[model samples]
Target: MSGAAPMRVLANATELIELLAGEGALPLVDVATRIGVPRPSIYRLCEGLAAVGMVELLPDSRVRLSTRWLALADAARAGMLEWRGAPEVLAHLVERTGQTAYLSVPYGSSALCVDWCQGRAIDVLAYRPGSMMPLHVGAAGRTFAAYGVPLPEGDRRRRTEKTIIDYDELAADRERIRRDGYALSEEDVTIGIGAVGVPILAPDGTLRGALSLGGLVEDIRKHCDEFVAELRAGVERLSGV
Candidate 1:
């Protein structure tokens, strides 16, 4: 019958979970500010969530929704009768471009390739699903990193003669990617492969992953403008879906 009891009832674990999940990744201060709760209370709630594997604390102390959510997503994808259409999207892109197309999601300090479609043209370098790329390298990794994901410390130490390794330089590149809506890497990872990458964002604006195209630098150079246009168009179509 008391208002105090009603207030307590409104602040259940479910409410906390819903808040964190809806907000995607958030710092303690931002979460506290958004939820109108004190930092200590938010930290305690995050600790509880982290204990249960629903949330994870990043190295920088930011709290993020965990991979456990992917289980439910995978389950849903398994049940959907029309879900078989997913591969065709990547297939269509590869078919059109005649280059390796890849979809990757950020995992820990790397980007994990979750899906790929290889072109008919043979290439010395090929990537398969589950292959991991360092977050500081390649177009897919750079796309994810550009959207505020932390790059691994060790990766920063290994500087490609042509690549940006300094934090400030990397930060500037990230800002450029954010503004340009795609990432371009020429021999940043492999000597012969050039990559073009676009970030895939969720409806709520959180970074879901990145879609990338990899091909020989000479081939890509011949169609550089067209390749970027097609890559951006493909990502736009996927984002709508």
Candidate 2:
């Protein structure tokens, strides 16, 4: 809308990607026709992206995702530290809590899961790597809120019956977590699933991400304190890294 050039550029880039995903590469004219933009604009977009290593422009006047993207993907994969004992820790967390365990880091305005493990008794496992949940509807979000992540006003809406809709109420909850060093969520994202979330603090005391355990509400309530202790220990152990 309006003259938001950056937004328009981003939209054109995503549309071009979707087209290329299904149709491979095409010249500026075909790409502009499919995306309903001017050919000159598409050409400029492609050139800009190609300069930044996002696309490769061929002598045949076609374009495709650059081979360099593989290095970027590898870097992102390494960023998760999945190869460096994270999965084992999550598996152990599941065993100790008898609930699904998650490691969610803040990505933009959402909690982005990088790893998880399903517990033995868990019949429902919903989260996985690349899954993103908004910053207002889960234990991970509550952890971000407690640490002053600055969620937008729109995310304060209802996603479930137990989702906190009022900013004042959510503020009080965040305040409690900031004081208590953890957050508990009950039936906020999915009904009947309760969770406890704790922050894995960095050496500088910055919030890295959240580690959470989720399962049936009854079981979660029965072992919440133990789960909290275990989660805190996990954070402390990670902090030594």
Candidate 3:
């Protein structure tokens, strides 16, 4: 094959991988439709990926991630040591606030929970590690959307009836979060739950992740100011380290 042809094929494969990572699973027809490629082209790409163990074809003909990708992710994490300080940070947050603390990053149209530390209380099981959460509803999600990542396109239709839903209202709140250096939600995403979030910025001043504390709305309300202050302090401490 010519050099240009090989480069084109590589680009196509990369795009296919991104789509699979974003959507989790896709059928050949759906992939073709979304990528605007011909069905045969998508089939050939999937076949090549499956052959290399980068993807898998399920019994129902749907395609999803393969173990090879997980291996690669593990290797990358081990190299980067992304979680080197995460455990201690989480423990400190949970101990300081007596509430569940979580770290989340933007993942496609959602926020992916990377790690969590639960308080001594038994009610801290709402958010599970590796869960994908809506970016338009929760405190952490709103902080992410306000910082750079846009809210999910479809969230406008499924407005959060429990809290703020108007796009303009949310946009205004985003401005406040930017100014305040923190974000708060009270019975907004999940009923009876309140949360405070602070953006995690990289040394280059780019948003890298978010840290949040969760608790019962009433309890959070009673101590909202103190909690926000503490959470902000913790984020600042983490940033300096």
Candidate 4:
């Protein structure tokens, strides 16, 4: 019973970290309410996390993740040996396309953004490092699915009216991506935003990851072919790594 109790606390701590990562700083009470845990338990968890440098308690009674997590995230990114050259590739893509570039890998039924380079244009708040997008929702996720990663089963959330939530439509979309050798998402994840992505595949055709570019809907639509060219070139550079 003693051992089990500590494990439960650890699990709760993980949930707390995830919540902080997604929602940013929040008061202890709000955290408890959102996490469905008691106030006393959450307070203890925050203190324990703070002691370990995983999170910090603000002067205003809000709790936020510590900067130490940045180093840990960097270390995790470095550990993916296959993506060693991803940063440079993303940078090059951003330079050529003038759109935000991202490197993502399949995480279960989601595409996890591990690295990104912001472009000179508008900022895309839909995804960032350490964020995950469902395989049916975004260009990167769709690229993963078209290239062999399994699409998640069950009802998919519709982020916008353009999001393909129907199974048949999603299946057809995947087919189009496969046939075209790239995935294109127009206002699917975020309204007024668009993205194009291609799979980073191993020599035997196994998916290694996804390379994508995103920007305003108009810019993405007008320059899609050019963006796809640059993205494909970047993926080629990554393939050599």
Candidate 5:
């Protein structure tokens, strides 16, 4: 007799998170369409995310991810690694390549360096803990941007003459990065400093973060294949594969 009085469960927040992540910033309509949920339900989920610092509601009625996710990810990294991120893995890369290695995650519309291990031969430190880089500036940042993270205007503005400030060029680079599963920033942030970056994705295919190794341009280029292999191994380990 009560079969007609069936209860309904609400959509999980993770669904909303994964949608926003795959499509980048989007208006409620896009999310609703993608998830086959009503616009109002999507709006409600977005509102909840905005309240929790997981997302930001734009004046243009779009929703974007907030930087707070980075902090949460760092917290989760605890006990997994001695600190936050694949420190032991990064150390291995440093040992193999003799370059500074780092783990970066989306910081609002930018990229934040969560953890790093410096190589023995390095003299300059490009990104240390708490150091933020514009999403269009470096390998790590570009990795996030290419994988659906929004790039801020500051990243669009050139830092040095070598930086890729042109939107068209950046778009082209994004395409390449998407296809390759990795990227190289050739002095795009700082002269004489270059990096190779790979995206770290959650099992759900959401972009959780990125990993990068920075050093001289030629050095990274010389060991590009090796670095990518090591980086992939590190990612597999970090992911508990």
Candidate 6:
């Protein structure tokens, strides 16, 4: 097979996995339709995934991810060496602030949430494990920009009325976050939700990831300073500093 053939198959396989992960079991025809692959190709892809133990072919000709993914997920978390101390830090932040805490690392022009601890007060469902937030919005995304990760080009996505999409405004926000050592967002991603984020820096000062607290807009805005302090403390603990 030519190199392109394998790359195409790999891309299709990845898309198939993400589709099943999001939508649960579905008929092979529907999977093909949703993924824009041919029906025959979709079936082959499903068979390949099942053979690899990544997914299961249901009795009704539908398919779903296999239980092996649970083990894989656990293994992935454990394998992320930089985030070795993340779970304890996330738990402590949630306990300290009573808000959802997330650990995200830069992935291309987006922030990929690797782990999170749900808050006691409310669930801010905008970000979760495996979810991606773009670099120009959200506290975690902006923290990457603040730490010198360049933003993706093109008009910024307008997720909410309060989302800052203008390049000049985003430049200012990045500068402020750089100066303050944290980023704060108020209803930028989801209405009525707010967040505070701080970059997790290595001892040599490279960006490791971002730690964030998210909750109700008013609550987050009201306690922004305190949240920044708590998140920084968590980063300190994670870094053993």
Model 5: runs farther than 4 Å from truth?
1-85, 153-155
Highest lDDT: which candidate? 4
List model 2 lDDT by residue over 114-143, tens digit each: 777888886674555556677777788889
Comparing 2 with 5 on TM-score, the higher-scoring candidate is 2
In model 6, where is the ten-residue run with the lowest total lDDT?
Answer: 15-24
* Model 1 lDDT per residue over 1-241, tens place: 9988557645745556555553467777887776677788778778887898988988887888788867865675456443244466678788789988887788766777776788766666535554566677788888889997888776353435656687888888899999998888777776777878888787788987887888887877787677778776777677656
Which residue runs of candidate 6 sit more than 4 Å off their true CA positions?
A: 15-68
lDDT of 2 at 72: 67
Which pairs in model 6 have colliding backbones?
none
TM-score of every candidate relative to the true structure: 0.62, 0.70, 0.70, 0.83, 0.65, 0.80
- lDDT, candidate 3, equals 0.77
Per-residue accuracy of model 4 over 1-241 as CA lDDT, tens digit each: 6999989898899789877876689999999998889999999899988998999999999999999988999999989887889889988888888899999988877788999999889975588998888898889999998888888787487889999988999889989999999899999989999999988888888888889999998998999899888989998899987
Sort by TM-score, best first.
4, 6, 2, 3, 5, 1
Give model 4's TM-score versus the native structure.
0.83
C-alpha-based local distance difference test score of model 6: 0.88
Q: Is candidate 1 or candidate 6 better by TM-score?
A: 6
Q: Write the per-residue lDDT of candidate 3 for residues 160-225, one digit (tens) a residue.
A: 466666778878988998998788887766677888888988878798888888888787788778
Clashing pairs in 1: none
- Of the two candidates 3 and 5, the one with more favorable lDDT, higher being better, is 5
Candidate that beats the other on lDDT, 1 or 3, i.e. the better one: 3
lDDT of 4 at 8: 88
Give the runs in model 4 whose Cα sits over 4 Å from its true position: 2-8, 25-43, 57-63
Winner by TM-score: 4
Model 4's lDDT to the true fold?
Answer: 0.89
Question: Which candidate, 1 or 4, has the higher TM-score?
Answer: 4
lDDT tens readout by residue for model 5, 116-188:
8887766675677656777888888889889998766542667678888788888998999999999898888
